[model samples]
Structures are given as structure tokens and as C-alpha cells.
Target: MDVSVFEVIGPIMIGPSSSHTAGAAKLARIAKDIVNASFNRVTFGLHGSFAMTYKGHGTDRALVAGVLGLYEDDEAIADSFELAKQQGLEYEFYEINLENVHENTVKITFLLEDGSNYYVIGSSIGGGQIIITNMNGFQTEFTAQYSTIMMKHYDRYGIVSEVSAILANSHINIATMRLNRNARGEEAFCIIDTDDIVPYDVKECIEQLDGVIQVQVINVND
Candidate 1:
């Protein structure tokens, strides 16, 4: 598919650079959705361009605001630190080396109040577009342009068929699918991008499957 002009021109956001500020915010929001729990603390590992200009470009503020559930264009992003403190969301930022990734990239680790944790790597590829490249050490790539389902399951046979069948039955068309694993027949990650929304009940259906360990549904709000 061709990249749309609007995507290249970028969406409405408070930014000096879409890659540094807007995309950073969206990356945080993506992590928030995956964590899907109350915030405890978060750490952002900025790389390359992000590390060099985050403070001046508001990348750091944008990230924190996003974790607090703010969108990229929200004006409140400038006061994200104060907002975080008010909500008791502790956060920190650091410079890190992400070998072979985009210059505008970050690795975020989230600690939930419920004691759950999540790690994600994302890069802003300009024009407010971002790609999630890794989740929990699974190398992958996805743009948050469609409703998505991330399933953690045992790397055994029939799991893919089971999930796909459910989506098919629900009349949801799969736009794309990617799977990664730690080792054969071990823990695996499946990302399914669908053309239409997958309802909550359908998610529950997949969660009930024998080998499915967890399911997270992210609706593309943008």
C-alpha cells in the first residue's frame, strides 16, 4: 500500500519533530494499552535523536503524559510531569543504545500497580507514524493503524487455527498476522491486525482457548 499524503504530512500534534515528540507519546500510549493496568512506575530509554533532543522537543513530557492516558495532540502534555506526580505515577528517563534501530527510538519498561510489568521497543519513523519493533524480547513490527490482538500462548500446534477460526467466525478480516517465539514449542507471541474491531467477547473466547496464556486487544483510536 502506498503511504497516504496525510500520513507523510503528519497529524495534529504539539511537536518540534513528529518523530521525537508525537511518536514518543504514541509509543507510550501503546505500552499503556499493553500493560492495561494502573500505573506504578515507568522508565524510558531514549536512543539517538530521542536521547539528544528529548528535553528541548518535549519528548520526555510527551511520553509521561501518554502513560497517564493523554493523546499526542493533547495540550496537557507540557505539564506531564506535574500530572504524573498528581496521579502518583513515578517515572524516569535515560539514554540508551539500541543497536541497528532508527535514530528516533525508545525502549520503555512499565511497572503496574497490580505488580505486572511490560517492556516494549518503538521507533518514530517521522510524520507521527511509529512502529513497535519488540515486545517482551520478541522481535516484531507493527504500526498501530488497525485494531490489533496480541496473544501469548504455548508454541504448540492448533493455537493459530483456533484463534483464526474464532476471528473468521466473528466476521473479522485479518489484515496481517505475525508470530514469534522464544524457542520451538515454548512461549510464543502472536500479533493479529484486523480490518475491523474485534469485540471484547471475542477476546474472551480466545483467552479461554487451552494454550492461550493472555490476550490484549488494542483498538486503533487514531
Candidate 2:
């Protein structure tokens, strides 16, 4: 595994613990990014060490701060709960045991304004690093370490090829891609991590392709 300078020397963040605070914020931020919609409520299922010491370690505040789109280093993290209330974001945290996962894990459930709900399960892997283990109902995994694109679409032949072709045409180098489907001819999920940033128009092109139902991108540099 490649380690970043932040991992080795620790990230510059407002934190009592890197795993609990900074990583929690990062995970929440990425989860918010994937939704790409307004969510009025978010429920947090805390597990293991996170459930045990979250309040004291400022993990709760960090998570709320991130959902508010505050960076990890932002001083506003100290007052995330109040800020969340002011911003019309409702949140609640519950302690729960998760199976076969890292110690610092949290399940974020989002209730969007459109009467739809989404969920993401992620673990803070220490030193401000995080790995998103699952999204919606798909058993997907990604670190969000690069500019990532995630989509849900109908399962059918040529969808992947067409999307990749668009990426290739745009000169986007795909570093990794994962495809998953619940069953043949059913809904599917695709995650593509690119070495270079993908332009908005390229994403729009993919969306216009037949079979694509939804697409969301996370530009790490943003």
C-alpha cells in the first residue's frame, strides 16, 4: 500500500485522534459528495472504538462538521453540532456492533429531500485515512484517494464499454474500476477511479449513454 506524507507524519487537522476525528470527517465528507443532493437528516451507526469513545474524542463533532462540508483542519469542527443545527442538518448517532470490520467504523444513513435514502459504511483506518466499505446495498470498496466516479445503472452488455470508451476519448486514464450487480439483468453499480480529473462534460456524456441511471463524482482536489 502506498502511504502518503499525511499518513506517516500525520495530517494537519483539528483532532484529538486522527482515526476518530480527521478520518471521520473525511469519510462523512466523501459520503456527502456521493449523494450529490440535499439531505435533511443523517443517521450515524458507530461501531467498536468509535462507539466507545466518540464523544470524548470529538468524533461526533468531526462527523457533523464534515457533513456540513468543513475541511478537517477547519476550526469550525469544534462547534459542528451547533453549526449543523443552524444549517438545517439533523443528525443522530447510535452505537452498534458490525461484523468482520475494522475497529473504527461508522455507518452513515442519509435521508434525502426527495424522500429517498442512501447509506455508506466506512472505516477510519488510522492516521486520517479512510476506506468506504459499502455504498447503498452494494458491497463496494474504495478509498477515495483519487478523483473517483461512481454510478448505478441497469445491468446490460456494452454499458461498461461505452462508459470506458467515453473516458478514453476524453483522455482520462482509469486507475481502477469495479463492477457489481445483484443479479443478471438487474441494477448494477460501477466505480471508476481515474488518475486524472474527469471533466464535467465527460460525465454528462456518460450520463447520456443508455442504461446509466445515476452518476456522482468526487474530485479530490476540490
Q: Which candidate is the best by TM-score?
A: 2
Q: Write candidate 2's Cα lDDT for 1-222 as tens digits.
A: 886788787889987888999999999998888778899999999999999999999999999998889889999999998998898889999998999989999999999999999999999998898999899889888998889999899999999999989999999999999999999999999999999998899889989989999998887899
Q: For each candidate, what is the lDDT?
A: 0.90, 0.92
Colliding residue pairs in candidate 1: none
lDDT of 1 by residue, 26-68 (tens): 8888878877767689999999989999999999999998788
The numbered model that scores best in lDDT is 2
**Candidate 2, backbone clash total:** 0
Worst 10 residues of 2 by lDDT: 1-10
